[model samples]
Target: MPMNLLHRMLCRSALWERTSATRIVPWALTGLDLGAAALEIGPGYGANVRTLASRTGALTGLEIDPGLAARLRDRHGADMTAVEGDGAAMPLPDSAFDAVVCFTMLHHVPSAAVQDAVFAEALRVLRPGGVFAGSDGLDSRGFRLLHVGDTCVPVPPDTAAERLTRAGFTDVDIETGTTSFRFRARRPAA
Candidate 1:
């Protein structure tokens, strides 16, 4: 997932980190227990990982960008695992995680089919009864401007539930906010 220079800079900025830590992640995770092991599909500059690592006992970040993934591994190696991989086709084992999350990054996946593949992969990697939750910005003029020269495919909140259900998720939930949408779904325990 390639990002424009401005987008890349913003992701690595202090403001982005602060907002992600204080607002976005907290809002998405309300009432949800991430459990012992959690996997983040696209940690980007790891702004969310800082918060996620504190909540879960063991955390893993699977990033598509090799450089970002390497940096994450170098910086958070002691506290978390960082793997360079695609969300649509994870290099992880089935039922290996207690939770899987992605935030503000799915739009970079290039297409709806890939996004659905990511959804399915998230379900596959979760332990039965595991959770998948995250947030992404809605399509807007501002959002579009921020993604110029990038692969931007915003996932409409309206259609997310159906996509999740089709991916074999249960209890699918999507909540649209002022500028973004948050979602959560569960893998049935039975």
Candidate 2:
């Protein structure tokens, strides 16, 4: 079935929050020490991009939706560089970002392999010792109201950790709250 306007707006809002909230607080708490450059995949409405841009030395936002990407660029102006692109195949080179953040975009990727590709791309762009963090709603009774692109993605903590490990991230940390599962993983320092 086609999504109504309200559903579309809700999905977009949730996506923005899922991708931004998980990282924002932790980043702020850690003093936003992300190095020279950072990247946010599927930045949705650019909430994460705004925060990261303010904290990091430089920030890039990649969004598949042209409309949203344009809006992000306009909104963020010089604080961030917005790109129209796919997360699975990023336009940036390996180790381009000191940190990579992805919100609730994995499940909307449509296939497990694509999700893996996105995760791998995130790892590829991250510098050694860099961090990647994301959050998504879990399929708990309380979170039944949570939605991602019209459906729920059951993001269990263990499964998210496994995925991060498979994507070459070490020191995986998974945290769960009442409504969401948050995963933070780091690339090893050489």
Candidate 3:
């Protein structure tokens, strides 16, 4: 389901901006070049698209919410492609992207199995040696209250990397903070 107005506002709020997760997650993904074809799984409100666009030669995003996807396309359509699509079952061609990114949205996946499928899908869409990077919020009372009415599952510390490894990602590195976890994992070269 699409986020309501309140949820949308909060996702794009200063409160969300100030979080350490927002500041540090990108760092964990450093060194693996974002390359020409980059994809972000859930770019809410198009805030990071500008920064990412500067780094990537071409950028595309898959967003679950049709309304938000339309808004993103309208706002950044010249440089980025924003489409309404499912993360776990993206329609993109295999090995099409050089990098895949997500942010603060893994918890929204309904189940661990589904989340793993999403990870596998990221691997499927990535070209050889491409990087998959992201951060998801840790389970917390405050964050939960803020995201009330959504099915949120904070990945336990140290488990995300293991799951990514199981999903065929190597060189998996996961970093944990008080409120969230970020990771960078790569598909092996051909």
Per-candidate Cα lDDT values, in order, are 0.94, 0.72, 0.83
Tens digits of per-residue lDDT for model 3, 24-75: 4456455668999999998877767767787789999999888889998898
Score candidate 3 by lDDT. Answer: 0.83
Model number with the top lDDT:
1
- Give the C-alpha miss distance for residue 47 in model 2, angstroms: 2.2
Q: After superposition, how far is residue 114 of candidate 2 from its true place, in Å?
A: 1.4
Clash pairs, candidate 2, are 19-103
Give per-residue lDDT, candidate 1, residue 82.
97
Off by over 4 Å in 3: 1-5, 14-25
Can you write out model 1's per-residue Cα lDDT over 1-190, one digit (the tens) per residue?
8888999999999999999999999999999999999999999888887799999999999999999999998888887799999999999999999999989998999999999999999999999999999999999999999999999999999999999999999999999999999999999896
**RMSD to native, candidate 2:** 3.7
TM-score of 2: 0.81
User: Candidate 1 clashing pairs?
Assistant: none
* Local accuracy of candidate 2 as per-residue lDDT tens digits, 1-190: 1234564576458565564556544543253366789887877766665566666898898888888889988887688889999998898898888888766565556566777888899998888899887666556654544342343445556677888898899988887766556677888887
Instruction: Output the worst ten-in-a-row residue range by lDDT, candidate 3.
Output: 17-26
- Provide TM-scores for the models: 0.99, 0.81, 0.90
